[model samples]
Every structure is written in structure tokens, then in C-alpha cells.
Target: MTSPITTLTLDGLETVYDRLAQAIDRAGEDKRALFLVKLALLNAQALGDAELFQQQMEKALLNL
Candidate 1:
């Protein structure tokens, strides 16, 4: 037997992320950037997508 597959969609997350990134940039703290990325990854884990967690972590670090 085969199991079912589940998909995840985060509508409007990009826009929110962009705005938050802008704020982080303004704050100008490397540690803050790291923690924000950690927070995002933790949320991703709650959503059950480890791959997305990693991707978001990297993406969060991009501007830093």
C-alpha cells in the first residue's frame, strides 16, 4: 500500500518576509538576523517541512 502525500502553502509569506527583512536590515544586528532565521526554521518544523526549514534558513541569511 502507498501512503498519501500532503502539501503546504504559505500564502503571502513572501511579502511579509520581505517587509520583516527590511526591518531587520534597519535594525542592523547580525545576532537578530540569526535568531529571526531560527524562528522561521522552528515555524517550518511545526509545519513538518524540514526541507523548507533549511531553505528558509538560508533565504533568511541572504541579506545578512
Candidate 2:
């Protein structure tokens, strides 16, 4: 079965965006990539759906 799409409200999105930016800054220039990979892996594990994660990865790659 496909996972349901979840949408964050504007406030929630802003909160998340702010926190993520803070986290990346805290990770510093050298460790930022590693930190992001670790974060993505942890989130994917929590999500428990490989196909959904793959789809999300594809979406994230768009226009970049």
C-alpha cells in the first residue's frame, strides 16, 4: 500500500525550516554533508517505507 501524503502547515513548515537551517549551521562546513546524510537515513528509518523514501528523494532532486 502507498503511504498517505502528509502536508505541513505554514507555521510548522517555517519551524522545521528554521530548525534545519540551525542544524546545518551547527554541523559546520566540513560535516554538513555527513550530518544531512545521517539525518535523512534516520528519517527514512522512522518512516519505514523504502519506496516512499525513494520517491521523496526523487522529488527533492527536482530543479537542483
Candidate 3:
């Protein structure tokens, strides 16, 4: 039920995230934590719902 562009974007993001994760690992845990916070802030900004996105981000962090 997804558009081609959406699917492509998701796949591309996944690949980029994989690489980011690898680089963060090499850089150390501090960088990794910063990367996660950056992702959360980006998500909230992009979604236009800072409160809701933040709650979800907290849940994800807890689960992680």
C-alpha cells in the first residue's frame, strides 16, 4: 500500500542508517548517543509534533 517513492525512500534511509550506525560504533558510544538524539530531534521536527514524537522517542529509548 505504499508508493514507489516512499518505498525507495524507506530503503535508502535504512541503508544510510546502517552506515551511520557503523560509523557511530567506530566513533564510540558518546557519538552514538548524540546520533540517537539527533534522530529524535529530526523526527520531531519533521513530523511537526514535538510532544508526541518525543513520547514515542522516549518509548523507543526505553525499549532499546
User: What C-alpha lDDT do the candidate models reach, one value each?
Assistant: 0.68, 0.94, 0.69
- Among all windows of ten consecutive residues in candidate 1, which has the lowest summed lDDT? 1-10
What residue runs in model 3 are displaced by over 4 Å at the alpha carbon?
1-27, 61-64
lDDT of 2 by residue, 23-51 (tens): 99999999999999999999998788998
lDDT of 1: 0.68
Give a tens-digit lDDT track for model 3, residues 1-64: 3222223488898998898778778868767788767766775666676566667767877946
Off by over 4 Å in 1: 1-15, 22-27, 52-64
lDDT of model 1 at residue 19?
81
Better of 1 and 3 by TM-score: 3
Models ranked on TM-score: 2, 3, 1
lDDT of 2 at 52: 85
Clashing pairs in 2: none
